[model samples]
Target chain A: MANPAYVAVDWGTSSFRLWLIGKDDSILGESRSNEGMTTAAKTGFAEVLASHLAKVNAPENLPVIICGMAGAKQGWIEAGYIDVPASLSSILAGAVAVPGQRRDVRILPGLAQRDQARPDVMRGEETQLLGALGPGSTGSQAVCMPGTHSKWVHVADGRVTAFSSFMTGELFDAISKHTILSHAVAGADQSPADEAAFESAIKAAYEQPAMATNLFFTARSGQLLHGLTAAAAQAKISGTLIGLEIAGAMTNAGSGVSITLVAAGRLQGLYEAAFKALSLSHNTIDADTAVRGGLAAAAKAIWPN
Target chain B: MANPAYVAVDWGTSSFRLWLIGKDDSILGESRSNEGMTTAAKTGFAEVLASHLAKVNAPENLPVIICGMAGAKQGWIEAGYIDVPASLSSILAGAVAVPGQRRDVRILPGLAQRDQARPDVMRGEETQLLGALGPGSTGSQAVCMPGTHSKWVHVADGRVTAFSSFMTGELFDAISKHTILSHAVAGADQSPADEAAFESAIKAAYEQPAMATNLFFTARSGQLLHGLTAAAAQAKISGTLIGLEIAGAMTNAGSGVSITLVAAGRLQGLYEAAFKALSLSHNTIDADTAVRGGLAAAAKAIWPN
Candidate 1:
C-alpha cells in the first residue's frame, strides 16, 4: 500500500470531502460528509476536521490542504481572495495558514472580480479552474461550472479575464417550490423525463431570453391549457434557466471561443443537453476529478518535495 | 345618501374589496378585507360576501357584479374563461351567475390565450384591460397591468389580440424572501429608497435582458465589494425584474403602440419610474377605477333599468 502523504479537503457551504493522498499521488483513503462550513461552524471546524481525519486514519503530523468556503470569512479562517485578472498560480501563493494547529494546514484563497460595474466572486470553483485548465493553460476559453449558482469564467492566456455568476439553479429551486409553478411540477420526480420539452424551452429562451419570466409562467399555463405533464413542466423550468444563463455567459465571450463545461451527475447531463439544443459544441471535464486535481495542485505547491 | 344601485367586488387570490355603487355610478360605500378567494374558500364565500355587504349597508335585493380570482376553479364558483382573439364585450356576456342566491351574484369570466406555444390566462387583469381600454376603443395599445402576475395585453379595435403574463411581482417576492439576495436586502424596508440604483439597474436590465440573473447576483457582490446599501440592493432586484418584464412585454407590441399603465400606489410609482428610466411615454390609470369600471360595465349589461 502506498503511504499516505497529505490530506486534501474540499469544504463547501453544506458538504465536506476529504482525500488521503499517497506519496505516489494515489488516493489512499477518502471521507465525505454533510458537515460542511455551515455545520462545522456550529459543531466546531477543528472537531469536524479531526473526526474526518481520524476516519481516514490520517497521520497526526500529516499536512492538510483545503479549498472552498472553509476559507471564507465565516469559515475556519479567512484565506482572503486574489483579485483578477490574475494568473491561476497566484491562488497557490495566496493560501493562508490555519494557526495554532499541531499539523500544518493551509486553505487556498478564492478569486474576486472587483469590477465596479460587474463585481463577482468565486471560492471552490477557483480550485476547479486551476485543475481544469491548469496553472499554465493558454488560449481563450469560456469555462462553465454549473451548480446552485452557475459560474461562467472567461479566461485569456491562463488568466481569468472576467466571470459572472447566474442564480439559475437556486432560482429554479425557489421558483419551483415557492411560486405557483409548484403545482405544475408537483409530481415531476415520479414522472418520466421530458427531453423534448427541455430542448424546446432551451431554444425558446436562448432565442428570446428577455421573455424568461413570461416563459416560466408558461409552465403553469401550459398545464392548464395544453395538459403539459408535471415532468415536462419541470423540464421547461430547468431548460429556461439554463438557456437564460448560457445567453448571459456568451455575451462577454468572443465569437468562436472554446467552451468547457465542468460538472458531474444530473447537472452535467442537463447542461450538456442545453448546449446541444442550442447547437453549441462544448467539451466536458468531470467535476470531481477537476476539484480533486485542484486540491492536489494546492497540496503539492504548499509542501514541495 | 343616494340609493344603492349595485355592488362591485374585486375578489383576488388574497384580498377582497367591495364598493357600493349609487344610482349615479358613484361609490356610495366601500369595504375591504383580506378575505380573498383563498381565505373565503375555507370560511364560506357567501358568508364573507354577506358580511362585507352588511358593512356597506347593501340592500338584500341589490345585485352584485364581481371580477378576479373569485371566478377561478377553486373560488366560490367556476366562472371559466373567454378565449381570445375576443371582444371586450364578450367578458360582460360571459358572467356566470351563482345559483340559489337571493340577490343576483355574477362572477366575470377571465381571458385565456390558448396558443399551443405560449398559452396564458388572466383572471382579474382582463377586467382591468376592459376598463382601461373600454368596449368601443380603437387603435393598437399595450395595456400593462402590474401585479403578482403582471399581464400585458395587446388590444386593437376593442378586441383582445393577445397577452403575456410575466411572473415579475411574485418572482420579486419569492427571490427577496427565499434566495441569497434576502440577506442583501435585509433592512431594505427601513432604509431610504435608492432611486439612482434603481434607475441604473433598470437601464442595465432593459438593455441586456439576458444578463438579468447575473444582474441579480450583483446585489450581493455590490454589497460585498462596493458597500451598496440594503435599499439599493433591494432596488436593484426590483428594477431588474421590472425591466425584464418590460423588455419582454414590448417584444409583442408594435413600434408605435401606445402604452397604458393600470396600477395604483406603490406599484404605480415603481412602474412609472421604470418607464421613465426607459424613456417610454405612457398614460397611467388607477387600478381601482379600471376594475370598478369593468364591473360597472358588466352590471349595466346584466341588469338594465
Candidate 2:
C-alpha cells in the first residue's frame, strides 16, 4: 500500500465519498457512505469524517480537501460562493477551512449566478465543472451535470459565463411519488425500462418544450388509453424531464456550442439517449471522475506537494 | 325557496359541491364538503350524496345529475368517456346511471382525446366547457379551466375539436410539499401572496416556457440570493406553473382563438394576473356558474320539463 499524503472528499446532501491519495497522486484507499452533509449535520461532521478516515486507515496528519454541500451554510462550515462570470480556478482560492480540526480540513466554495431574473447556485457541480473542463480550456461549451438539480454551465475561455439549474431530477422524484402519475409508475422499478417509450418522450418534449407538463400527464393517460406498462409510464416521465432540460439548457447556450454531458450510471445512459433522440451531437464525461478530479485539483492546490 | 327540480353535484377526487336547482332554472339551495370521491368511496357514495341532499333539504324523490370524478371508474359509477373529436352534447348522451336507486341518479361521462401521441382525459372540465361555451356556439375558442389538472379545450363550431391537460396545480402542490422548494415556501400559506413576484415569474416563464423547471428552482435560489419572502416563493411557483400552462395551451389553439378562463377564487385571480402580466386578452367566467350551467343543460337533456 502507498503512503497517504492527502484525502479528497465529495460530501453531497445525501451522499459522501472519500479517496485517500498517495504522495505520487495515486489512490491509496477509498470510502463511501450515505452519511452526507444532511446526516453528518446531526451525527457530527467530525465524527463522520473520523469514522470514514479510520475505515480507509488514513494518517492523522494527512490534510483533507472537501467539496459539495459540506460547505453549505447548513452543512459543516460555510465556504461561500464564487459568483459568475468566474474562472474555474477561482474556486480553489475561495476554499474555507473547517475550524477546530486537528488535521487541516478545507471545503471548496460553490458557484452562484446572481442575475436577478435567473438566480442560480451550485455547490458540488462547480467542482465537477472544474474537473470536467480543467483550467484554461478554450471554446464555448455547455457542460451538463445532471442530478437532483441538473446544472447547465456555459463556459467561455475557461470562465463560467452563466449557468441554469433545472429541477428535473427532483421534480421526477416528487411527481412520481406524490402526484397522480404515481399510480402510472407503480411497479416500474421492478420492470426493465421501456427504451422505446423513453426515446419517443424525449423527442416529443424536446420539439414541444412548452408542452412539458402536458407531456407528463400523458404518462397516466397513456396507461389508461393504451394500456402502457408501468416501466413505459416511468420512461415517459424521465424522458419528458430530460428533454425539457436539454431544450432549456440548449437555449441558454450559444448556437453551435458543443455539449459535454457530465453524468454516470443510469443518468448518463438516459441523457445520451435523449441527446441522440434529438439529434444533438454531444460528448460524455464520467461524473464520478470529474468530481474526483476536481477534488484532486483542489487537494493539489491546497496541499502544494 | 323555489320547488327543487333536480340535484347537481360536482363530486371530484377531493372535493364535493352540490347545488339544488329549481323548476324555474335557479339555484334553490347549495351544499359543499371535503367528502369527494375518495372519501365517498369509503363512507358510501349513496350515503354521502344523501347527506348532502338532506343538508340542501331536497325532496325525497328528486333526481340527481353528477359530474366529475364521481363518474370515474373508482367513483360511485363508471360513467366512462365520450371520445373526441366530440360534440358538446355528446357528454350528456353518455351519462351512466347508478342502479338500484329510488330516484334517477346519472353521472356525466368525461371527454377523452385518444390521440396516441398525446392521449388525454378530463373528468369534470368537459361540463365546464359545455357551459362556458354553450352547445350552439360559434367560431373557435380556447377554454382554460384551471385546477388540479388544468384543462385547455379547443371548441370549434359547437364541437370539441381537441384539448390538452397540463398537470399544473398538482405539480405545484407536489413540488412545494415533496421537493427542496418546500423549504423555500415554508410558512407561505400564512403570508399574503406577493403579487409583484408572481407577475414577474409569470412573464419570465411565459417568455421562456422551455425554462419552466429552471424557473421553479428560482423559488429557492431567489430566496437564498435575494432574500425573497415565503409568499414570493409561493407566488413564483404558482406563476411558473400557470404561465407554462398558458403557453402550452395557447400553442394548442388556432390563431386568434379567444381565451375563455373558466375558474373561480384564488386560481382565477392567479390566472387573470398571469394573462394580464403577459398582456394576453382573455375573458373570465365563474367556474361554479359554468359547471351548474353545464349540469342544467344536462338535466334538461336527460329529463326535459
- The number of the candidate with the highest lDDT is 1
lDDT of 2 by residue, B2-59 (tens): 7889999999999999999999988888999999999999999999999989998899
Off by over 4 Å in 2: A190-192, B190-192
Model 2 chain A is weakest, by summed lDDT over 10 consecutive residues, at: A186-195
Q: Give the DockQ (2 decimals) of all models.
A: 0.89, 0.88
lDDT of 2 by residue, A4-31 (tens): 8899999999999999988787888999
Cα shift from native, residue A269, model 1 (Å): 0.3
lDDT (Cα, tens digit) per residue for candidate 1, span A1-305: 89988999999999999999999989999999999999999999999999999999999999999999999888999998899999988888999999999999999999888998899988999999999999999999999999888899998888988899999989999999999999999978722299999999999998898899999999999998899999999998998999999988887785588999999988998999889988899999999899988888888888988
Top-DockQ structure, candidate number: 1
- Tell me the fnat of candidate 1: 0.82
Report the C-alpha lDDT of model 1 over B1-305, residue by residue, as the tens digit: 88999999999999999999999999999999999999999999999999999999999999999999999989999999999999999999999999999999999999999999999999988888788778999988999999899999998899999999999999998999999999999988832299998999999998899999999999998988889889999999999999999998887785578999999989999999999999899999999999999988989999989
Q: Which ten residues in a row have the lowest lDDT in candidate 1 chain B?
A: B187-196
